[model samples]
Target chain A: MITTAHQKIGTPSITTLSETIDNETSRSRIPGNTGIWVGIFCVLVEFLMLFSVYFIARIHNPEAFLNSPDKLLTIAGTTITLFLLSSGYCMVKAINAIRSDQSKTAFRWVNLAIILGFAYPIVKYFELSWYAQHGINVKGGIFFGTYYYLTLNHLVHVTWGLMGLIFVSYRTVKGGYTSESYSGLEAAALYWHTTDILWIVLFTFFYILR
Target chain B: MIGSAEKTWFILMGLTILGAVVGEAGNVGWPLTLSVVALIYIKSSIVIDHYMEMRSANQRIRNVLRLFIILVPMLVILSFAWGEEIRRFTTLS
Candidate 1:
């Protein structure tokens, strides 16, 4: 018996095949797509820079930071924080539901998330009005300036997140997301969660730690 | 049993209220400050882990997010502790 040494060069062995598949699965463990990850990175870097500035300003003007929180309405901050957390939790449920292929449940969750998201700007609107009535605008001092700058910057991002949520909810209702193909939905959820994370930091800095 | 994410939401709510109560006390001494920042750290972690689903993510991204949450609170502690020194080192005429 002659053993022919010819072997299929590119053919996958069971071990190699399983390893390759595991690698792909791990790669897919990233919650969203590459483009969304890049977007998330940009958002994170931008906020990181802003936070650095915040620390620098705090160092130089500790008094300003100390006095800033007292002037703020804790109720407003608390309301906003709860709203963000609730919305973020809804997004998580949305993703989890979609992963289980429960599109109806996911759609309901996404819509609930969006409605909760709209509460942020509404509370913000009242909060700003309170600031105005109290004569606490950006021009007040270093603290007010930093407060307005950071909070307003965060508000802009929230608006973007709200837009993303609205679009995602629309698609969710349209059966656009399946268990294996919810990258878009996940992308929006990721962005929404990022916004919520950023707001948590903002709330702590401005409202929690005096 | 309640879902994990819902459990996280409850924990976050508890922390938020705790922080607010401390802040509302209007006299944030050192111990209060420590607790506040710690709450900040924990809340951020819950969002990153449970909400964002970052636990099983690629190591690099997960590490980056963790590093960020840690760094922010650490900076808060540093500023509260040695702020004047940092200002001196950072100041330029």
Candidate 2:
């Protein structure tokens, strides 16, 4: 019997077949088209707009913006940094629990994530209170104004992040995530991570960058 | 991977506290300020790439976002330089 080499050459090559298989496997692995990408895009845009505002404000009033009280910034920074990162870490545990089909453990960690996030706004409120006492209202000089503006904007983001966590926690309690359909947990993790990461940026920019 | 990002966060936090201490130990002045800016750039990159998990993105996508990030600081630094020039020229006038 003649070998089918001639027919094989006429057919799509093995390399092409293997390439198709590889593509499908990679898609199955990550499933990037999930709405998590949209979350990432929103976060990227939000921060960029924020930095742009800072840039324009500084440009418009170079001299008047000096004299930041680093002490107030550091207090807020440290508190937020600790909790946001802790939340991210806790969220990883939650994701793992969901992946392993441990709903109770997943729910526990998700709650922890929410609690950590809830702490953020409280810390921010204390810092804002201190600023108010110091005559650093939202409409103060350029420095104080930007100080309040940037931080309050970030506070709003934290609020939104808290809402996301709360929703995720509710869903986890409702059996929305599992080893079989773990994308919800993955999506929530992505949001938690974004919040954590954005906080780091704010910490550095507001507290460290001077 | 998550653990690695967590470790990075710890390091960034440590550096932040250290920056605070340095700011407090003395005047925290321009040198410390410059150091903080550099540190912010480094830490923010880590956040964007690792925690945001954009490290594995397409290079073009990474570069575009990187450009945006880089430009902000550059503009900020330039403002200082231009501000100085404006002051000097006004004094001369």
lDDT of 2 at B45: 76
Lowest summed lDDT across 10 adjacent residues in model 1 chain A is found at A1-10
The lDDT for every candidate, in the order shown, is 0.88, 0.67
After superposition, candidate 1 runs with Cα above 4 Å error: A1-24
Docking class of 1: medium
Model 1: lDDT equals 0.88
Using TM-score as the measure, the top candidate is 1
Q: Write the per-residue lDDT of candidate 1 for residues A64-163, one digit (tens) a residue.
A: 8887789999999999999999999999999999999999999999999989999999999999999999998999998888889999999999999899
lDDT (Cα, tens digit) per residue for candidate 2, span A5-120: 76678566877899888765543454223476666667778777877667566556655544464445676777778788777767777876887899989999889988888888
TM-scores, all models, native as reference: 0.89, 0.75
**Candidate 2 chain A lowest-lDDT run of ten:** A25-34
